[model samples]
Target: MFPWGDSDSELIEVQGPRAAIAKPKSFHAHGVHFWEIGSDKRLAGAILHHCRSGIGKLRACTGGDQLALFKIGITHDYDSRFDLYRSHGWEKMLVLFYSSDLGQVEMLAPAKHVAAIAAAFAKTSSDGALSAIARCPQNDAERAMQKALCKFDLTLDAPVTYVNVGEQCLVPCLKPTDYVRTLNERGYLHRLIGCPIDSSAGALSEFWARLSKAEPQLEVCQDLADGLVDPRTLIPVYIHGDGGRTYKHDELMIFQFQPCMGHGTMHSRPVKPNSIGVSLKGHSFTTRFLFGVLQKAIYSNDPSTFERFLEHMALDLQSLYHVGVKHERTGVVFKFCVIGVKGDLPFLAKAGNMNRTFLHIRKRPFLPHSPEDPPSFFKLDVLHLYHLGVGRDFGASSLVYLMTLYEAESIPKAIEKLNSDFKSFLLSSKKVVHFKQITKDLLGYISSKAYPVGHWNKAMDTPVVVQFAEWLVEKFGGESTPDLLIRSGCKAIGVCMRTMLSSALWLDRSEAKIVGDAALHFAQCYGKLVHYFSRKVSACTIWCQNYIFGTISH
Candidate 1:
């Protein structure tokens, strides 16, 4: 981050990441020393004036509770001008600052108050004497700084710039120190960061010692203890991308990081505060964060393009890691050790430097496909598979059977009667439905056509579906029912769907086990049921209908 030389060495050392235009520099709000480097003394093409390092104190202001602001007045041979400023005290960093004129400041309030106090002794009215005072007359020869209040200013700010990273990629990178300072000014950075401390071997050694005593089971707890004493604050950044719509329904790959304070807090907060985005347009998703924009896009066509950019970005971040940035709220120079990359499986696989292919590329049907791992390795969301999926099948078939058993002159009347009862049941249950109401089209059972399916919200409508069918069965069919096989088949299938929602977001373990057992049972039962019943039998026809109609919601 900082290049130090011998005491006799006057050569100003400058370094930058490979493919970077200028050497990395930090703007530490806290006191930080800067080496005055002339153009002839350092790397060619770098128009640098200063070199700030993780060294001694060079304060902007001596007082506490006062904001340190710097003047950006123009001067020819600025090198000589800044040298004079060194005698007074000012840190000029190589990093760019986003500055605008804040206007020429005047010390009128304090001066007026002092003058008013003096006027009191003279027996002249303090208020009248100050109130009557007008603007001072100005001449062209007067100092541009002015002896009176004027409209103009010279102040430094957080500078965002477009810099080259690779041959084809250029990204708008904010100085890491500036971003961190911005966070601290907002006064909520403590909640996001796990620990904040100054850099010292003693502090780091103390942290590792405390960490050694912590139980290995508490991952996040141990992580919190990283920056508590040590200055090297480890932050987890996640990169996730896919061709899908965002929560707002915009298409992009979103990157984010988790809050690391308190126990299990890291995992609890999954919202991404910072990111490089990927957009989905023209049937192709793009990793965009390159050149002249707040975000850079890494072309997804070549994964190595992204890999190279990261290498460059990492080199840039090393400055902040070692030199540190000042926190506005805490008034402490915090050296961050941002590491631990975590994200979705696909992103991790693509981003990681490994020989293994966790995901296979697929295009049109003509495109060749192969698996790095077996089909069994891949998992599906059990909630979608069961809760909103196969479970609906059982509901649809049971509804169809119940209506058929209603014994009206025709199937239409039977469906209408069952629909009335179902509405009453929903009212009694006081359940909210996503869809307005269950319609004949949703059921696939109108006068013109004859099919039945369950269509409703995944979770809320499930209980109603099950209870309605069971109620109708007990009310009319009972023990004398002929479509007993149909209802039995639906429940059997549901037993297989014993999949939890959040608990089993994926059928990685428990749900998979349930699914396996249920499938095996279904296969064995189907073999006997199909063999026992003739092809022409209505029992087999009804069972097939349940499987087809009920499993898929309309």
Candidate 2:
């Protein structure tokens, strides 16, 4: 008797409630909705032939396709494999090994392919010939001998009869249905052992050792079964750090993922994209907080700390949005209360009064100041940046072009008024400047094109519009800096403009059209300002060091 074979003669009680519902309709290849280069019917037939007879000559046989089928069946349960093979167009199927015995090849093939495999085995005159011969049984003793032969391939002189074995036994193979059901409920499949023995002969307890070793080797052909979408990539925006100047940055600075449906299509939407969006929102909040902290640090005489903060903020932004190319050429900058872009646009909008008040902190504003203010350039303020175009066409949102701000005493009260003003502008009044321009442009354009205005209702509900009110408050209410800070602010205006323009040009393609030309022009002019601040900062660092340490010898 096999050392670990369970007794086949023992009376075993089978107990379980019947399935509550009929078996679900099995998914087949014909059921799949797919359009591809080849015919699955022909492919399925070819696969069936190959499994039974071996791959002799198939015109388009790729090893990758062959491997895919094998891995699909062995790793995935039957139902999943069927769906996968049907969808992926696998033209060949074969087995590698069984969980019960790793050394031997297990069942392989199309349902009809087994007949050819059996015929092939009948012709082979190796030791495997006995395994084939045992398939045919003439009488009870021959059947018993065949059953005994299945236990060990070795031949013995004594005829192994069912009567001598003391009992007839049936070892049913665990069906794929059971395996899949277990996996669905438990999140994994249990190792099943199939071994036959005379039940009258012994207890099943003796087989525990062999049963323990029945675990199938699990190799994930595709690690991401739900099609490669991880929730982390969609919504990552937070940057956390100690209160010091240490900035944690991400090396993989871009958010890129292959949606199952493919890119640029709705079906290719990443699984859990909404969750990712939320996660990225949290990250944005964190980055905004840190950017504020770093700017404050700069005022505290720790400007170098802003560099670290910029690194964190840059990574946080990249995690959610496709802004890697922007950050690459344009070095991201962080300040005490607001982070600014060193490129054509400030990827981060300033929170609170940083743009309004911190005009003299650096040699230039982080964005191009309008031409109105002055000896240097226009003083960077929310009014000038948004209303007159801050970063240029590419860096600035079309919506920002619609806003203008005036000084307010208490920010929260101001925000309430701002909200009321926006509501009035949209619903009650037609006096807002930007809306007037938009309405005129839109009406004229629509009259010419003959498109109805109702189509734009969805755009009215766009997140940009819906969130604009709260966004404004968040931007200004977080920290309050007095306009006097603007007086002490150095000319960071130059550096801000330069960074934006350079980044804009670097990311633009050579064949860019008229819009591209405008963007490039913006980048070129703004980028030049960065150079001015670099020289001034270099000189100031030296002067501050010399004045404080009393040693310029180094």
Candidate 3:
């Protein structure tokens, strides 16, 4: 009996969980069998077995939409790869082959045979035979395949038929005569007018002056006379597109403003109510601009620039009351709210800056810091702390320094010895194992040497801590004697770490807390060094704690 059983070919029964007991299977309906062969060799073997058993000759083979009763063969050796298939006559068979670990199906039929196959399949199905091709190549490969098929001119004698197949059918219709009138009545559409200009600093200043003269009610500031500065010259400022809108009927318009010195360009979009536009241009009297300049000065480590920036910032905020009162008189409301500020330690700690800003305000007799006030004052970037303070400065630099002390050849030899020991232990155990299991067992064995080091309170006396401190002293000499070169390396590490770890939203809060605690302990133990390594590490720990308990908690 055949594998499918000697039933009528049109009504053969399929054997599976979903098979019906009362009804016979239809001629067109068949169950698909899927096999996941482990390797190319196994796939080749399976193909050869199918051919030898005459399964390929008996079963119908499908390539794209074309079906044929064709012989299939798997090439066993490279010498007979193409020659064997070619000798068998291309029209008589389809070849099963493997290349670069992927299974490929190739047609051996000539153009005439391909054309006949395409035409016959097209007549039997609504979708053309070409559409039936499984895992069709795309782009250039698709175009090449089409070009090859076109050579055969696979035209059908019958008209092409299409089945609905649940696809939506769109019907064309004419709009009602009153559609425009109905839209007008609803007031759903508005006309927009746009004007494009060169928008250089001089042009922007002139435009602002003309606008201010035309609409004195808008109360455009006197600062507009100087024109807008290039945005690229300063740290980027981005406002959400949806923000700063107070009215639904507000028009959306963007004015391109180029800087005077040809530095870079910026855009100005007018806010609602007064049509007063603001660009990311800084002035000597604006707090926002002063703050930006302060940041640049801090980053560049310029003391003169830092002082100058602070002086300008102070002058800007001096007329704060008058500016507010003036805008109120003109029916224009000016609002300023400082959200949390993020910066590295040096920047935030500068005199009359983050630290002193809060202190001065708190000391005032009239206005005092209150618990009800929002905590949007100053924030340290947690990433800067972890990467710059802990990972780069301490962990990575220490590891690199330790590596430098050992001979290059000795390190590889040590690793080889460890690997050999691990493999020997695995072999002696005689248990079924996988990559993960071996790794777990190896790490478990190695960690035994570093275990029993109690909590942070006992960290000072911990064997690991003692050993590391001793090693540090022995490797680099007395604590008082500073290695400027190695210290510079630590600083470089801190800089890199800050850059890499600046974003912490992706990390689990608990994980961040744990790392922060570890860093704190590290700083407390080793921070007394004159090189200030501990101070940097402590900064990261503090930042982490602040982030977890403050930002995330709120």
Please list the Cα RMSD from the true structure of every candidate, rounded to 1 decimal place.
25.7, 31.5, 26.0
Q: Model 1, residue 178: what's the lDDT?
A: 54
Candidate 1, residues 1-554, lDDT tens digits: the string is 22233563232322321122322343333222224332332221121112122122123222322444455433323446656776686655322211122121111122333334444554644543232222221111122223322332222234675555457566665544455555566553443343333322333343334434532333333444554424234332222222334323443333333332222211122212221111211111111211121122354555565554444444444554456666665466655443233333444444454212222212111101123322322224333444455546456655765676777997668767887887887788675556555566655444423334456645546645766676677667555433454445545555664442212212346667776776555444434443444343544555554443344222
- Residue-by-residue lDDT tens digits, candidate 3, 1-554: 11232332212333332433223344323322112212343333244443333444235323322454444344433234334545655322222233343233322223333344555676656664454331223212333345554644432121221212112422121111122122223331110001111122233344345434643332122223333322111111111111011123332211111111111113222222212222322331221111221123132444444434333333333222123211212232221111234444544445324334332332221111223332323344443444333332343233323333444576445335434543554465443233322121222222322211112222112222223323444545544423333343344433333322332212246545654555444443333331344344454444344442334221
Give the higher-TM-score candidate: 2 or 3: 3
For residue 149, model 1's alpha carbon misses the true position, in angstroms, by: 37
The 0-to-1 C-alpha lDDT of every candidate, in the order given, reads: 0.40, 0.27, 0.30
Candidate 2 deviant stretches above 4 angstroms: 1-283, 286-292, 295-424, 428-514, 517-554
The CA lDDT at 245 in model 2 is 28
Better of 1 and 2 by TM-score: 1
Please give each candidate's TM-score: 0.33, 0.16, 0.22
Sorting all predicted structures by lDDT, with the top scorer first, yields 1, 3, 2
- Cα displacement (angstroms), candidate 3, residue 231, comes to 29
- Compose the digit string of candidate 2's lDDT tens values, residues 502-531: 332112344234334543443443333223
Top lDDT prediction, candidate number: 1
